[model samples]
Target chain A: MTEPAAPIVILDKSQMAENIGAVARVMANFGLSELRLVSPRDGWPQERAWATASGADWVLDGVRVFGSVAEAVADLQTVFATTARSRETRQPVRTPREAARILYDDRASGLGVGLLFGGERAGLETSDIALTQGIVTIPIDPRHQSLNLAQAVAINAYEWRTLILDAPPPRFREAEPPAPGQLLLGMYEHLEAELDAGGFFHPPEKRPSMVQNLRVMLGRAGFTEQEVATFRGVITALSKGRGRVLAKLAAAKRQD
Target chain B: MTEPAAPIVILDKSQMAENIGAVARVMANFGLSELRLVSPRDGWPQERAWATASGADWVLDGVRVFGSVAEAVADLQTVFATTARSRETRQPVRTPREAARILYDDRASGLGVGLLFGGERAGLETSDIALTQGIVTIPIDPRHQSLNLAQAVAINAYEWRTLILDAPPPRFREAEPPAPGQLLLGMYEHLEAELDAGGFFHPPEKRPSMVQNLRVMLGRAGFTEQEVATFRGVITALSKGRGRVLAKLAAAKRQD
Candidate 1:
């Protein structure tokens, strides 16, 4: 059997180049080479990042840059965002070890996997997180939640390395690969457009959060490609039925 | 059942204050409070440590300084030293997760436990490692083994916190509490003295390594207080028997 592909490490809006370097060093330490950056505050190719990487040039040398989180994780089939605190999203939260196991299993099944980390200041935006499958929260002491950006990456990378070194027996059932992020994003947008037209989001001010909640709820389904197509078809059928009902009511009113 | 006591963190001969601060932050993040320093290079209470601690003052405030690793862990019943590379000693090497499970069980049994870390420049000395019952290796990629001191502490601390949060069912048989470090040290001294007089260490230059091996071998036994006492009595009886034989041989020579 072929070896599983290592999970891609994505840092979103990271401020410090030094932290990026530290992340790279840890990634190299854990045998993860793929790194993607989303709108780094200092921009890419910072010399300081190389300086702090401690000779982990392979990871930094091949870094990928993206303008947004959506583009950063575009091709990944399963992505988990690291969060410091619990958010209001309906997404399932997992520990680092648990997430690593899932990622290992997903990679073993030939699905691309990634881990998304928010910048040092504000973590991944709720809208950005809605695009992922689940949340990875390090079980830390409540009184002291000051885990820095690199440290967060280190713990995750360490867990991933552990799985690679000594993998546990696959306890989960063999399942269909989750649809790639791009396909899931398409389903989300399709449903959102219909919902918007139907005035399902009552308060204009609540539309953003409502959309996020809906997207998060659906993202947890781990939809396969066929499932995404079927769900979108279901949405299309419901919306067409609504249109037909409205046209009949209008004709009946005209006759009256 | 009462909550298990958190493991103490001992840094042996740490060099940088900032790394010490970083270690403190992670310890607080993982619900470990006790911090012991064995001969920090810059002495205690460096202002930079506080500045880098990111407001984890409680750990810094209660830091205890000792002259040596033996002094720092004198009261603890169980200690595991963290090492980046595997050593040739007979001590069992455990992954961070495994060590955390053992430490949790030991703590639950009312035994004082600690994690010993080496300095940033050089990891724990072999003699200091001999003081520990086992070695805790983080299991990083062998290609890149540049884990910094704080990162090492963070991984171990993270594992410990996981055990506290979602403790698994205790899987081991309930055993007697291990003898404290002081009692074990006494037994080691007694045995080594006898071995020295008996010329068990062949070459004078190899005495240090031989003594370390002996201590490490005996340390794994996790002897209880009663066991230590019994072992010491056995050593005394053997040494006395040797003395009687020597005295009889000398008297026989005089008659001749």
Candidate 2:
């Protein structure tokens, strides 16, 4: 039935309401709905969160709050903590992509899975991390290990969406198929006639090889019909531009 | 010796300095150093870019400016255009993961690889996209096809890094290795004793089965030493609170 992804995104002690808004926007971008806030600093229902959410009001409106990280994730069967540094804990750590892979399988099994993101300053404390089975650590500049809060959440959300939905490779169904060989030959002839009239066949002996090369190049491209028409329009523009240049040159000669 | 993994990151007519700075930061995160600015809106050496880059000064310092996309990617052996919408072009379209897989091979063969990121508003013109061999379209929210510019670059860089570096699975060195069965049993004994003293085993007959279930759950978790310690701490806190409540009841009886 293509159920929308419903993994709980638990934000622990998040400091900035604006960043919370950004997170909601990113989560919506990936179709993740469940949001749980644990001990937000400025308290819940911050107007700043709604203001910065842009069009992701649904995520903010449906959020649940909890007093502690343990209670926040009590219902989830699988949980992951995102921390910038490798901590001394039992849980396994995975890159965002790897974590998404595991989350995809766990979600398919109908067991609730959630991701825990720490506050703006220091990330998840060891006690909070101990509750989760795994950690998701994004590879960042070691010298500067922090990413903006929303960027961190955005990467994970993007990974999860990409894996589960399996977006189709791009195709242009609207485009008419490439021009037939015969029709392409006709285009070549027309373009060649125009070029020849414009004295493009200079040093006449080289003209045959040049024309043959041009034909081969066009054939290799397998240009679509619309593209061929566009090229024809370019030729028309060039011809009109040339006519204007010729008239200007004739006027100058007459004045001399 | 490991070569500095270099790929030309080309931003085609990017409008915002903040986006340019962000692109540079993401490129640096993946060890991609080459930056080619193709017709940026505010011209070059933007002070705002340096402010947003955080510590990616190297990318900004080595940036090269070009008048067009063609000029930007001229020296590269392979090029990819990242666009959200499907375009009618001869170029093959690949997911970022797929493109990274191909680029990984091409880069190993010593062929320079490059990516083209379009402007903030409309994406790369089809003519610009046609210059590349492949298109990388992130499967985004169909309704919200466009992504913040820096985000697109970050996802691609992550894929490339994961492929090349073989990021290690996270491990914690000091967690006393998953607690031995004997130690886990000891934790169970300590917690159950505390709970019994607090009358948590209420209606007494059901207590044994509930304890068994708790033991099974903890066993399934493969609790580590640190985690067990944390659970024990929670048990201690609850038991102490119960002792206080009992003392309060005795004190009230004496007052009566």
Candidate 3:
């Protein structure tokens, strides 16, 4: 699914309309469409939230307001309380990435997960945190330990989107499975024969392991077909140079 | 070092002091200390930025204000241009996560990196984006595609912080590595014997693979020691019940 519906973002007592608008905007950016407000400071459906949202009306249109954090996350199967501060409670703490993974896995299998973020002032109280099973910490600088309201939401939303999307196709997308292992083996064999003739594999006793080591090292490069061809051409040039050297030495001896 | 400093954030022609202040605050949260302001509309070192920053004065104190983006990122090895709109330029695009991984790896190994973000309006000009080797796209909803300046910075900053931070210890710290494989095998064998005595092998044909399949299925659960113990207890209870039934039948036969 292009959009995941489970991550119900519940902002507890958000201070500013600008912050709420920012949260909605970033949520749309990451494909998160659900917005649940728990007693926002400026009240529900503020015009400033709409105006400041730029063009994210879809998120504003789907707002669900609740009286408390418990009511906001009542139907959620997994709830993560997001805060930058340390809590007195013993709930398991996860970094945003780890929490994203657990939520992504749970949501994929038909469970709704919610992330609870605290307001701008000091973050969720001990009472607020008691509502959820786990905490997601941002690991900010210990000296200045505050994140603006939208900043906190944006971080978690970004992690969730990245994890759920998985590794994407590169924009450059010219890669082709790296020429396969068999072709690489043929290149190894061709190069090994050239090496043996050129006396590059010295001290006959160590020859086998040396060739095997070179093959292994080249395999680690995971070369594309073009690179393999270039290497083969280089080997041909080296062998040709050796032949020319021998001819030059014989002619020089005759001249002497 | 606890903090790696390579990603220098360069803001090009920012219109407002508040947006710049918000960027500084988020950067402090993510451990990035460098800020390069390229020709701000309202000029540099505004008190508005200082007031909005809350406590991220360190970033403002160390800012390198310049006349252009080219001058701002001159000494950096890698520069990523962040834009939501598509550019006609042929630069490869990366999601914030992929770009963050590359920057994190490079910065950790001592290479300087920088991210270029455009102003609040239409984002980077074609001429501005053309200067960079790669593009970082936010992948926003196509229907309504507007992201505020600070929100854009927050998303990329969060990704970089996440990539650089190694897996941290959980807050609750009650996790012991899921019960060892040896203990799991012992539990499997114990349960298997109880099932065998109960004649659950069924038709004597699919016994071995059936038992193995059950073990493999349970292994997927990744049970902790408590789960293993509870399962073993369940098996013991079932076996004991069977023994009681046989004893009752023998006693009734004697009475008859």
Report RMSD (Å) for each prediction in the order shown.
29.0, 36.5, 28.5
* Cα lDDT tens digits for candidate 2, A212-254: 5445333434455655664454344434434544455455556
After superposition, the stretches of candidate 2 with alpha carbons farther than 4 Å from their true spots are: A1-174, A188-212, A229-256, B1-5, B13-18, B38-54, B66-71, B74-78, B88-92, B101-113, B121-134, B162-256
Interface RMSD of 2: 40.5
Cα lDDT for residue A199, candidate 1: 57
Evaluated at residue B190, the lDDT of candidate 3 is 84
lDDT score for candidate 3 against the true structure = 0.69
TM-score of each: 0.49, 0.38, 0.35
- The whole-model lDDT of each prediction reads 0.81, 0.70, 0.69
lDDT of 3 at B143: 89
Expressed as tens digits, the lDDT of each residue in A1-256 for candidate 1 is 4457789999999999999999999999988999999999989999999999999998999999999988888799889999965545556677999899989887877788999999998988999998988889998998998789989999999999898889665433244566788898898888777776655666789878867766764565566676677556545544553455455545555655
Model 1 chain A weakest lDDT span, ten residues long:
A167-176
Winning candidate number (TM-score): 1
- Cα lDDT of model 2 overall? 0.70
DockQ of each: 0.01, 0.01, 0.01
lDDT of residue B21 for candidate 3: 95
- CA lDDT of A68 in candidate 1? 91
Error at B199, model 3, angstroms: 32
C-alpha lDDT of residue B138 in model 1: 91
